[model samples]
Target: MESGKKGGSMESEKKMLESNSILETIPRDLVLEILVPLASSSLSDICNTKRSCKTLNELGNNSYVLRYVSLEGVEVVQWEPSPELLSFLPRCEESGNPEALYRRGMVEYFCNNKHEDALKFLERATNLGHEEAAYVLGIILLCNKDESKEWGIELLNKVEKRKRSRNIGLSELRNKCKAIVRKIWLNNVVCPEEPLCSTLACKNNKRKRGQGWDLSDEDEQVMFDCKACKWDHERTLFHNMLCGSA
Candidate 1:
């Protein structure tokens, strides 16, 4: 019975050694690379893995990993940013992580409509070579009637050049930018008048009256009336410019 117990212990020791060897063989960078695509929930499981691998634990808490998981994972579900993810944003911002900045800008813009914060983060991300951030910020600037329009056009042009050279990922964003640019050029030809709610009083009047125009009827009238307002096209562009395809 003692011999049997000793044999069992020896086997367990061998198994433990083998597991440690396997863990050690997997490079930390490779582990981090694999973890980048995983969701926060998966990373939680990895952190709970029955091993004392400090690298694995570190990867689970890495700012870049948290940002990627939050942007790709929870953002799709229309949920608030996870606490674990939000906790890393400051670190990422301090580190000047472009992707993290972009994600934070998106959260602020979409969730809170805090345009100033969104623009600040997005501009930093863009300056740091984040193409998506540049594209988004450019579009936002394009929609505004301010000095930023020139900067917006410049940013879009830069992105266009980059896309032509690389042309991978961000296909939807590229298409949207193309459509927006084309629409901007078309504006010169169409000379569409500004919507009635451009002014504060007009907006307040609109609020009291509720959605002042019938876009569908106006759109139908455009076919017959050469002078009909391009309300449908303007409305569509307005929505797309602000909301984005995210």
Candidate 2:
């Protein structure tokens, strides 16, 4: 009777070992697919599991899994791409993944301030029909005050048209872009020289010309161009009224 009981115990242990081995042998991609839909909290628990659950923890590090969690608004540690994700970036870019390109552009723009690199990646993503990427690129271009402003406006208009055609609600990002464009159009005042003034009064002052007015307080009199009292009166008015001085 004792020998038969020991034999049964050995058989159960062997089956358990086989089951664990099978779980370890499952493909990584399949594991990731299964884990992607799990809640971030649950995923965090899995990552914190015992050393014996190393396979489960490793699946938590998969790029697709991490990206899905990010999209779900989960605050994963090192929420940005890890070395593993960076390693797969080239492959994803070659595969024409718009999200990958967008992510790369955002990292360059926000982290490194590499506008050119960000523009290159974001442009590629936008060309591939990534609306969010287009919105971001458009805003960046609009703020640049260079040749890119036209292209930025063009992209923003395209996005607006697409949204209208699809009957989609307007996004806050689109609204912000529209507001910026409107502000630029409404305030189309020009500065005469490189050293621009901060206030609208200074910018619109007709008496000011070529950079700024030269003010002097010699003999308790303010002077603009040393042309007698006319210059002094104008300078004093500018200093006392516009500049808020006594």
Candidate 3:
């Protein structure tokens, strides 16, 4: 029985070797075509296999392939958003990867709303010269009520200046994102009046309007005299004027 088990295991190993040899004989383009069909079909295995070869890796990373997987409703994290995807980002940064840095900043930004943590990654990416990172960092800082708004403005200004100098087209998404951040910041931080004081002032105004009385000493005195006259119509009107509710 042990000998039979050994023979079966050897046979399985031989079959695997033959299969691998057959795959190696196929042309590169044919390999990509085959893998493309299977990319969304078995995403986990595709990722594992893609990591093992440069040509296959490129095919997997192709924007076309990515779009297909995305449209097929493959979960982003499974088919595309794996941490190993960061490997491509560093290459982007090396090649003046503004987009890559922006994505990295976004990942950290959305991971948590921790401005301090996002700032560290964003600042580094910007300093290393990622223009999009600068722009995104600006928006993040702008939304962060606790952060230095002045710095946020400066970063945004820098992005504009850099874009003009580099002749990069205006990124509509970045601009829109920044505008959203500004609107939200205004709503939450800068726009509203001081709550306690505004509320108190509003209540005071409402009281005055409702009661039809000014909160002045003269108004108080008149109210006192009127109440006094109503309570004692028999007493001297002069006494009523002198004391309240006689």
Candidate 4:
């Protein structure tokens, strides 16, 4: 019985070694494509892969893997990124990882008050097709001059198209935006000072008011047809989305 058990264990070990060898023989870029998604979704798999062998360990530790590694695990490192991440974030940002860019942009915008630089990072993330980045960028643009309103609405409308398609947690995103903005001085900037959209006297409150994020077609149509109300509805929605969630 003991001999049989030992023989089984050795077979397993040999199979594992052969698999590792096969993995090493594959092209580096191909391996990276497989590993990046794994790292992004499963924290455990990549950690074990890194521990299994030298070639993989080196690959897992390098820029390609680091670029898209799960941001969820490192979310705590975002606002108060550790000493190492201060240096590491630039590499991830330079590699064009949307999540990394979004995180670093938040730190720069909210924590460091580096508005121009932060906007650049957020813009890069949005251009890379990061929807959450687009949502936040839309709100930020809305907070700026009136000239920014058109582009702001354009970006937001793009995201709103996808808002209901997947289980992307648009509501949760709204709450998060409200929470982050409320923590800083930008809280009031999001809400227009006019009467609440909840009230009939709201600047652009036409036939009826639109709900926070759930405006019906007719309600939205009314809000948009009247420019004051459109801006009102949008600003109010943003304001309420931020303040409402906060």
Per-model TM-score versus the true fold: 0.49, 0.41, 0.34, 0.67
After superposition, the stretches of candidate 3 with alpha carbons farther than 4 Å from their true spots are 1-101, 166-246
lDDT of each: 0.56, 0.52, 0.47, 0.67
Residue pairs in candidate 2 whose N, alpha carbon or C atoms collide under 3 angstroms: none
Q: Clashing pairs in model 4?
A: 204-229
Better of 3 and 4 by TM-score: 4
User: Highest lDDT among the candidates is held by which one?
Assistant: 4
Ranking by TM-score: 4, 1, 2, 3
Each prediction's RMSD to truth: 11.2, 15.9, 21.4, 6.6
lDDT score for candidate 3 against the true structure: 0.47
Worst 10 residues of 3 by lDDT: 187-196
| Top TM-score hit | 4
Number of backbone collisions per candidate:
0, 0, 1, 1
Tens-place lDDT per residue, model 4, 1-246, is: 999999999998787788789987899899888889898887678879887766687788678787777766555235576776676667778888888888767666756768889889989999989877787777777667567756777887778668646635345565565555554444233444543234455534545443343542324233344444554445556665655433
Q: Give the lDDT of residue 122 in candidate 4.
A: 88
Q: Which sections of candidate 1 miss by over 4 Å?
A: 1-52, 59-71, 76-83, 167-171, 174-246
Tell me the lDDT of model 1 at 222.
Answer: 29
Residue runs of model 4 more than 4 Å from their true location after superposition: 1-22, 76-84, 164-172, 179-203, 206-231, 240-246
Tell how far residue 164 is off in model 1, in angstroms.
2.1
Q: Report the error of model 2 at residue 104, Å.
A: 1.7
